[model samples]
Target: MKLSKGLLADLRLQPELQVPDAALLALPEKVLQFGTGVLLRGLPDFFIDKANKQGLFNGRVVVIKSTSKGDTGGFEKQDNLYTQCIRGIDGGRKVSEDIINASISRVLTATTQWEEVLSCATSKDMQLVISNTTEVGIAYVEESIHNNPPASYPGKLLAFLYRRYQHFNGSEESGMVIVPAELIVDNGTLLKATILQLAAYNQLPTDFITWLEQHNYFCNSLVDSIIPGAANIDTGYEDELLIMTEVYRLWAIETDSPRVKEVLSFAGADAGVVLAPDINVFRELKLRLLNGAHTLSCGLAHLAGIDTVKAAMANDSMAAYIEGVMLHEIVTAITDKHIRHDAAVRFAVAVLDRFRNPYIEHKWVSICANYTSKLKARVVPALLQYQQHTDHVPALMALGFAAHLLFMKSPAADDPFAAYYADLWTQHPAETVAEKSLSDSNVWGTNLNTAVPGLTKTVTNMLLALQREGVNAYLERVAAEIIIS
Candidate 1:
């Protein structure tokens, strides 16, 4: 039988499978969700569902599908019900649990149901607005909100807020707590600015703008989860929206208002939902540790014949490089007044454990996608910081940096510098390629060659060595030397 509200009535329960209480199905739609992607379903929707099941936050998500990609047929067919398979390693133990999520009250496609979508703003119960419309979605487009639907995400949101203001007489309590789960830093802050800009462009009322500024809470947030879709486990029922996620999950919300916290009461249900005045600590830790480590190590690990993150963890040399670079360099470099050494170490250990999840076959090549951008954003800051504190080259960073340079030799078609590097490598020697690539200000925001003294030379030497000795031999040799020191 296919999973649906009707199927939930007679479905047999397993010890590991959690089926929501029938009462949860009757909850009010309290959240206005912008995207129907698995990330939102996997993280925010997951938390809300879990909370509702616990009788904590009695709410449901009203999803607005704005993308031109897929239709709402699957959701309608399934009664907006889906399954969540939370799996992988945690604290060095296996985790396998299934949840038939009943968080979504309804799914409305914005194109056809713009009126209905706007109608959600009239719901007095709606207090939270959650969105994950990719990074590009939260952009400014000078389009009219008066159209059947607004042209941009911000426009649509402004229209919704305006409708709410009209319905509630611009009550201070009626404004939503907007939490954007886009990967970009300061997503909430930026989205709010864009919306305010659109409001001006549309010549919106000063009173409405006043209400927007005073009542609404746009919270900067960070969400981390390895939620690959659909585990395809036999549950005696089929679910089209099944999502498989790892044991680790975090949704760090930056908010100051107690009212916002009260509205986001679902946060209490999971340790993963952290509410704070500022989330930069979480942001820095995640970006510099988990993502940065991935960016730094992927090329080297892939070139060393390692296909997956778990495989690299199982390998002695690669494992050493991964842990060493993170603990000795990244953790040290990122340590500040807010970020202490012990805390960074703990986070690193957790990250390493996450990387060692035997069930998660995280592909190195997948991490290597958009290689140039990843290096520029993730590694460059850490590289500079590592040198700033120590004043000498971090051998592991240099090795990883070298591996990145080596990895970039066969330029990706999408890489802007692909042609530049293609011709550079074609025309020059390995040493020159290293210096030129590292020196290119466009590649990294700063000239890595001079900004961090001796970086260009060290990276160049390591790159040449990696080329001469092959990835495994060079990695093994350099990683051992770094470890010994």
Candidate 2:
């Protein structure tokens, strides 16, 4: 048997599986979602379905498939039903749950069903707009919304807003609480700007533009969860759309308006959904702690023959490096007033638990894309901050940096920094690699050698050590020292 609306009847008998109530399926469509991907399903849709079960947010979602690529047949065959297998460690405990999500009422292809997509604008219940169209989807593209469907996501979205303005005669209550889950820094702000740019480019009416600015609330949000493709666990019935996610979920939306809070009532269902007047604190914490640690540790972990994050955590040396760099190095370096050290400590402990999730196969290589740039963005600032406050060199971070330099020797020729690093390696001997690369101001913005006085020596020593002792042996020695300290 395949998982669908019909499967719910029998699934109710299985106490372990969380099956939705029949009444939840008949709720009115209140949210217009813009993506048909797993991250959207495992996070936002999961939250909505969970909320519906608790009667907090009694509404369904109408998804817009903006792109014509890929088959939408899976959704149609399963009646928009899927399973969310939340498996991972949560605050020093193991957690595993299977939930059937029935939040999506239907999936409409925007390219083919633009009229139907725009028609939802007339519904009073449609007060929320959610999207996860990746970072590129929110870009400005000059096009007309009248060509059956607009060529770009911003264009299509503008057409829908215009339709809503026309239907409600530009009423304030008809506005939407727009929250985008793209990984960019200011997703919602950038999206709204792109829409307004498109509106002006298309010569949209002045009143419509004013209504767009005043009525709609574009909320900048940051989402933290690892949806690693399909779930590995088996349900009694096959589910084509099943997704596996970690237990640590965070969807921090920036908003202060009472109306926005009320409209996003589903946030009440889970502690993971945090709504605040300013979410920069959350962003800084995530960037410096979670992402910063990942950037610094990924290359080292990968070079040490550890394939996944779980494997690295299982190894004592790799585990020590992870914890040391995060709690000891990265946490202290973050000087944001909004972030307390205890809070940073707590977040780091939870992050360790997440990293130790055996079910998640988060490969180190996958995190290695844009390796040099990631270091510059996530780690370089922290490194600079740490150097200013302390004279002692950050040993673990230097080792990680050394690992990155060594790993870059094998990059494809087309990578932006590949030729630069290749030339450095080709001209200088292994001993001078650190000094040569660290002194270059073009790639890393500042000359790392003079800026962080002792970094070059520390990094150079570790880079040479890695070449001589290999990562495995060197890691054991480093771990022994960390444990002793």
The best candidate in terms of lDDT: 2
Question: Which digits, one per residue and each the tens of the lDDT, describe model 2 over residues 1-485?
Answer: 99888878999999999998888889999999999988999999988998999999999999999887886899999999988998999877899899999999999998788899999989998989999886338878878877688878787788889999999999989998999998888899999989988889889899999999998999999999988869668888998899999999999999999999999999999999999988998888888888889889888998899999999999999999999999888888875567788998998998899899989888888888888888898889989888876866778889888998898877563347887888888888888999988888887889999999899999999999988999899989999998898
- Report clash pairs, candidate 2: none
lDDT (Cα) of model 2:
0.89
User: Looking at candidate 2, what is the lDDT of residue 100?
Assistant: 91
TM-score of each: 0.95, 0.97
Off by over 4 Å in 2: 411-415
Model 1 worst lDDT window (10 residues): 8-17
Write candidate 1's Cα lDDT for 32-124 as tens digits: 999998899999999999999888899999999986667898999998999988877777888888888999999998889999999999998
Judged by TM-score, which candidate is best? 2
Candidate 1 regions exceeding 4 Å error are 411-414, 482-485
